[model samples]
Structure formats: structure tokens, C-alpha cells
Target: MTKSARADMITVLAMQWNHRKVENLHKTLSMRFVKTTQKAQTEVDNLESLKQELNISLEDTEQWVLEVKQWAATDSNQTRHRKRRRLTELKKKLRERILQYNTIDTCTETIDTEAACSLSEDVILPWEAQGDMVNLRTKRRLFDQVMLVRRMEEEKVIIVKEMTQHCQNLRQALEKLDHLLHQTKDDIRNQSMFHKY
Candidate 1:
């Protein structure tokens, strides 16, 4: 081959080699860019999914809050009614006790005698024995009155215990409501911050 032809051949080969290197670099950069775009799209999809999850959580929390409110109100009303009924029953029992005690006292007063019977009276009359029996019945009634009062007191204590338990349940429900509200608020705040980004 001629020297100039050889030089031309060398120049052509060099240009071809440089073109191949540029093509390889372009392919590598293009592949990297495509991979980066796919990764970004996946990240965006994950963010959307997170937002959807947060929305569902918020909705469920809201429903729970409403349910709790309804229950609290209903329970509160029921407790109030129960307490009032117990008080009324207790008052009636107290009045009954007072009436019975007064009756017993009156009978005792009538039975009291300042003077002893005359020695000529060898035995009590049958009607007087019946009166003594009636007095014994009054005393039994007085004993029943005390028992009733004690039973009423026990019932009052039971009512207090039940009321306290109900109040504690109410407090617990309120605490759950507060916790849910706080969690929802925090979720909303996080969502807002994510959107800002």
C-alpha cells in the first residue's frame, strides 16, 4: 500500500474506535438513567400507598371515636337513672323504719306502769295476756325494721361499688378517645409534611 493510503486507513480506524467508545458511553448513561427513573417511580408509588393507608387508618379511627361517644352518653344516662332509683328506694325504706320505730315507742309507753298490781289479783286476765302477746309482736316488728335498715345499707354499698366501676370504665373510654385523637393528629401532620416534600 502507498504511505498516504496507509495514513488514511489509520485515521479512519481511529475515528471508528472513538465513535464506538462514544456509543458505549451513551448506552451506559441511558441505562443508568432508565434505572434511576424506575426507582423514582417506585418510590412515588410507595408514597401514594402510604397516603392511602393513612386515609384508611384515619377513617377507622373516626368511626371508633363516634362509637365511643355514643356509648359514653348512653352509659352515663343509664348510670344516672340507676343511682336515682336507688336513692328513692333508700328514702322510702328510711321512712318506713321511722314509722315502725314510732309505733314501737308508743306501745312501750302504754305498757309502762308506775305501780305494781294489787296483791288480790291472783292472775292476769286473758285479754291482758293477749295485749302482752300483741306487745311481743310489736317488738318482733321492731327487730325486722332494724334488719331492713341493714339490708338497705348493704344495697347502698353495692350501688356505690357498681357506680364506681362504671365511672372507671367511662374514664377509660375517654382516655382511649384522647389517644386516638392524638394519633390521628400526628398522622395528619406527617402526611402534610410528606406532601410538602
Candidate 2:
């Protein structure tokens, strides 16, 4: 081969080799990114489900407290024995509900860890990569997907924090209700004793 032709062939081969290397690297990175995003998505989905359950639990607890308060207030007019029996039932329900809240609290504790998931930044954008080994449009789409997942993760954290606070508040409220129930029971017992005397 002529000297110039041989040099040109070598240069072309080198370019091809570099391009192939970039292509392989890009493919590997993309696969990794896909896996990461899917994992993040799954985590988000799980958190969303947990949040729904938490919301339901919160509402139920609040309503339950209100119902208990209203019932105790009205029960003073009822016979003492009937009031005592009703209060006993309410206390039993509260114990079961506290158990449910404990389960939800456990889920929330683990969820914070799940939200710790992060995306790998060791990727080359198609436009920034050597030899255009990847499609810019494809890379952009992947980047968009990553951004979307990141936003969802951020929102999930905010929601979880808010709900955590709500859960704490609800727990305090439940404690108050429990104390009020005890007070109500004491009042009922005293009324019975007063009537007997």
C-alpha cells in the first residue's frame, strides 16, 4: 500500500475502535441507569402505597377519637352499668388500634431508608461522548426519565416527613383520648358509688 493510504487506513481503524469502545461503554451505562431508575420507581410505588395506608389510618384515628369523646359525653346520661360496658369496649378497640399504629410506624421507619436511593452520575451524555456513539435523543430521554424519578423521590420524602409529623400528632391525640377514657371510667365508678351510698 502507498504510505499515505496506509496512514489513512490506520487513522480510520483507530476512530472505529474508539467509537466501538464508546458504544459499549454507553450501552453498559444505559443498562445501569435503567436498573437504577426501575429500582427507584419500585421504591416510590411502595412508599405511595404506604402513604395511602397512613392517610387512612390517620383519618380513622382522628374520627375514632372524636367518636369516643362524643360517646363518653353522651354516655353520662345512660345507666352506669351500660356506660361501664361501653367504655370497656372502647378501651379494647383502642388497644387494637394502637397495635395497628405500631405496624405503620415500623413501615415508616424503614421507608426513610428506602428513600435513600440515589442515581449513579457516572454516565456520559450522548452529545458529550466521543464519536457520537449514542443517540442524543435517546440519551436525553433517559436523562428526562432520571430527572422524573429524582423529582418523585424528592416529593416522596416531603410527603413522608409530613405524614410522620401527622402520625406523631395523632399518637399524642390518641394518648390524650386514652387518658380521657380513664377519667370517664373513674367518673362512672364514682357515680355508682355515690348512688349506692
Candidate 3:
């Protein structure tokens, strides 16, 4: 072969090799990106599931608190004691759940921040650019949902506090009534004995 022709062949081969290397690198990066996205999505899904479970638990706790309030309103000492015990347990459970929710919220926030950072840093790859808008919308929706859950939890805490205060007031009223009844009974008994004498 002519020397120029041989040089041209070598140049073409070099270009082909370089092209293959770029293709392989792109493929590897694409796979890594896919895996990272999938993992983040799975974490989000798990957080959502946990939030649902916590909602169910909060509902149950509210119901129990209501029942305890009703029971405490009655004048029975035994029922009051039972109500207090149940309320304590419910409060403990609520505290734990709240802590768990806080932890989850932190995690959700971290994931969201990471996603936002990644989105900003991402170059406009053909595959990623196509879904960029969709991903942004989804992240916004997830953030909104998390905020809503946090608000709901805050409301639950307020409701519990109000219920506890009401129970305390009811107990105090019952005690005052009992004391007056005893005093009146004693006065009547002493007057009757004086009359008999």
C-alpha cells in the first residue's frame, strides 16, 4: 500500500477506537444514573408508605384519646384511673411516632435537596433532559405531600393537648362536687342528732 494510504487507514482506526471508548463511557454513566434514580425513587416510596402507616396510627390514637376523655368525664374513680393509664400510653406512643416522623421528614428533605442539587448539576443528556420537567414536578408534589403530613401531625398534637386539658378540668369539677356533697350530708346528720336530743 502507498504510505499516504497506510497513514489514512491508521487515522480511521484511531477514530473508530475513540468512538467506541466514548460509547462505552456513555453507556456506563447512563446505567449508573438509572440506578441512582431508581434507588431514590424507592426511598421516596418507602417514606410515603411510612407516612400512611403513621396516619393510621394517629387516627387510632385520636380515637383512643376521645374514648379516654369520655370515660374521664364520668365520676367513677376507677374509670378515671384507667383513663389516666390509657392516656399515658397513648401519649408515649404519640411521642415515639412523632420522633419517627421527624426522622422521616429529615430523610425526605435530604433526598429532596440531593435531587435538586443533582438536577441542577446534570448536563443535558438526551435521556435525562427528556424527563427533567417530569422529575421536577414530581419532586414538588412530594414536597407538598410531606408538608401536608407535617401539618396534620401538628394538628393531632394540638387535639391531644386539648383533650388532656378537658379531662383535667372534668376531674377537678367532679372532686369539688363530691366534697360539697359530703359537707352537706355531715351538716344534715349533725342537725338531726341535735334535734333528737
Candidate 4:
């Protein structure tokens, strides 16, 4: 074979290798994007469900408080004492739940942001500098994928923030309920003393 023909053969082989590498990298990146998106979606769903559950629990606690108030209207010192103890236990449980909710929200946000930023930053493939139309097309496609992943990350962040806000609101409500319970207990004690005098 002539020298020129041998050089051509070598060039062709190198191009084939580069094409295979680019293809493999693209597939790997696509799989990673899909997995990350699915995981984020699951986290958002779980947070929403947890928020709903917390709202229901808050309503139930409020109803319990109203019942205690009605029972207090009657002159039963023992019942008042028992209700006060139960309210304290409920307040403690609410505090624990609030802490867990805040911790989970922070963790989910950190993991999601880190994953998204890392993936987006590295999406500029080495093959992008090959200066061929084929590589150009591949680069464009990869860029679009990166944008989509970034958007998903932003959505996840928003959802986590909303969940955090809801948790804070619930915590405040519990604190208020605890304060009211303390007031009621004080009133009961005063009335009992008056009766004994």
C-alpha cells in the first residue's frame, strides 16, 4: 500500500475510537440524568405527603384542646390534671416531629443541589472540541440535557422550601397550643384553691 493510503487508514481508525467513546459517554450521562430526576421526584412526593399528614395532626390537636376546655368548664379537678398531662405529651411529640421534618428538608436540599450543580458543570464533553459537524450536534444535544437537569433541580429546591415553611407553621401552632394549655392549667389551680378556702 502507498504511504498516503496507510495514513488514511490510521486516521479512520482513530475517528472510530473517538466516536465510540463519545457514544458511551452520552449513554452514561443520560442514565445518570434519568436516575437523578426520578429520585428528586420521589422526594418531592414524600414531602408533600408528610405536609398533609402534619396538617391533619394539627387539626386533631386543636380539637383535643377544645374538648379539654369543655371538660374544664365542669368542676372536675382530676380531669383537668389528666388533660394537662396529655397536652404536654402531645406538645413533646410535635416538637420531635418538627425537628425531624427540618433535618430531612435540609438534607434533601443539599444532596439535590450538589448533584445538579456537579452534573451541569461537567456536561461539557471532551469530544466537543473535535471540530466536526457530528461532534457539534452531539454537544448541542448534551447541552439541552444539562439544561433540563438544571430545571429539575430548581423545581426540587422550590418544593423543599415550601415544605420547610409548612413545617415552621406547624411548629408555631404547637407552641401556641402549649401556651394555652399552660394558662388553662393555671386557671384550674386557682379555682381549686378558691373552692377549698
lDDT, candidate 1, 26-139, per-residue tens? 455455556555655565455445436434354543454455446456667779899778866765665565455446744553321212122123433334567523232333
As a whole number from 0 to 100, the lDDT of residue 34 in candidate 4 is: 68
Residue-level lDDT tens digits of model 3 in 119-154: 354433233545624333333444455545555555
- Compose the digit string of candidate 2's lDDT tens values, residues 1-197: 99999999999999999878654654554555566567778865654454364344445434544555554466554567786787667656655654555477444432221121221234332224456343333434333444555776666565556556656766897999999999999999999999999
Off by over 4 Å in 2: 1-39, 42-142
Q: Which candidate is the best by TM-score?
A: 3
Minimum summed lDDT over a 10-residue window in model 1 is located at 111-120
Better of 2 and 3 by TM-score: 3
**Predictions in order: lDDT:** 0.55, 0.57, 0.58, 0.57
Q: What clash pairs does model 1 have?
A: none
Please give the RMSD to the true structure for each candidate, in Å. Answer: 37.5, 40.4, 40.0, 40.0
lDDT of 1 at 135: 32
- Report lDDT (Cα) of residue 80, candidate 3: 75
Clashing pairs in model 3? none
Full-model lDDT, candidate 4: 0.57
TM-score per candidate:
0.32, 0.29, 0.34, 0.32
Clashing pairs in model 2?
A: none
Deviation in Å, model 1, residue 58 alpha carbon: 66
